[model samples]
Target: MRIPLIAGNWKMNGSLALIEDFGNAFSRTSFLSNAIDIAVIPPFLYLANADEAFEGTPVQIGAQTLYGEASGAFTGAVSASMLKEFGVHYVLVGHSERRTLFKEDDAAILAQARAAIDEGIVPILCVGETLEERDENRFDDVVLGQLDAVMKGLSEEQRRQLVVAYEPVWAIGTGRTATPEQAQEVHASLRARLRHYDENLADNMRLLYGGSMKPANAQELLSQADIDGGLIGGASLKPDDFIAICHAAG
Candidate 1:
């Protein structure tokens, strides 16, 4: 059975104080010691702070994003190696905001994924469709296309280390969530696509559902066969809600 992974993406939110407080509080919670994988993806500037706070706890630390190149004149861009120095265990790639707002194409995302994997960081590759795409009935195509570039070139070992989060664009941060059935359909499709590459990976790979996955709906959503976990947003900032979601996964 795949272990459930609930990763909190703090996004551009959080100061050093918030990171430290959250980590200290979360670390004290015994639920983390249960049969589940938990990670906190804080902003670039606070990775080390969060790491220190989460030290001696089961919560792993990660980064919101990273530059694809190892070293460059790209001012303000952070490399995977730098993140590794901060002990980042995972990296978010192709988040909808990065894709739509910053216009990061699939090629760049693929490069980022490769860089993170090379540095022994698990890349939480985000794939999703906008409301229009889903309405047009092209949701699957859009999502699977996002995966093709990054996934196609990965070695089997690299593939196994990845975590895929399906966050429908419309639902993200909009207080809307895909019904369990809707999320499961896409997760099943993603798993089926992976089977073409490696059966074991398809079976064992963890697929998380993103977009407004809160305490109230967590249990039902997680009950689906292919929905392995969640990539949380707003609710993650609150200790009770985030811990509740983790408990639901358990």
Candidate 2:
């Protein structure tokens, strides 16, 4: 069975002290079970701090974003290799914020995903539809389009190292969430799409739901057959809530 992964996306939040505190708090909690794996995706600036803080613990540190290029004259851009130095295990690629705010196109996202895979980092590729697209009945088309774009040049081995996160744009940080049934349908469809490339890989891939997934609703969502885990947002900042979601996953 695919190991349930509860990854906390710190986004643009957190300070060194906060991360250290969280690391200490998380270590003290009884949430580190063999049934699941946990990761903390902090901002790039604090990756080293988190890495040191969470050392010797089950919690792994990840990067919120990374540039596609390995080494270039591109100022203010971080490469996958740079993240690897900090012992980063996972990288968020094509996140909704990257796609919507920074205008990262499909090809750019694909390049970033490839860079992460090439550097031996697991990329949590985010794919989902917007409220407008869903209302217009183009949900599957939009989501599948994003997935296909990333799969274009990736080898089967690289594909196996990926973790797809289905985070509907409308529900993200908007206080709205996809019902268990709604989320399951999209997850099931995405898994089916993966089968076209490699049936074994598709069956083993871990698909996570991200969109205001909190302690209150985590159990029901985790109970879904297709929904393996979560790419948490706000709730993740709180140690209790994050651990609660992990418990739910277990």
Tens digits of lDDT, candidate 2, 131-221: 7888898976899999998886788888898999999887754666678899998999999999999899889999999978999999999
Tens digit of per-residue lDDT, candidate 1, span 52-92: 98888788998988989999799999999999999999999
* Model 2 ranges with Cα > 4 A deviation: 31-33, 173-176
RMSD of each: 1.4, 1.3
Clashes of 1: 0
Candidate 1's C-alpha lDDT? 0.89
**Pairs that collide, model 1:** none
Off by over 4 Å in 1: 32-34, 173-176
Count clashing residue pairs per candidate: 0, 0
The stretch of ten residues in a row with the least summed lDDT in candidate 1 is: 25-34
Cα distance off (Å), candidate 2, residue 5: 0.7
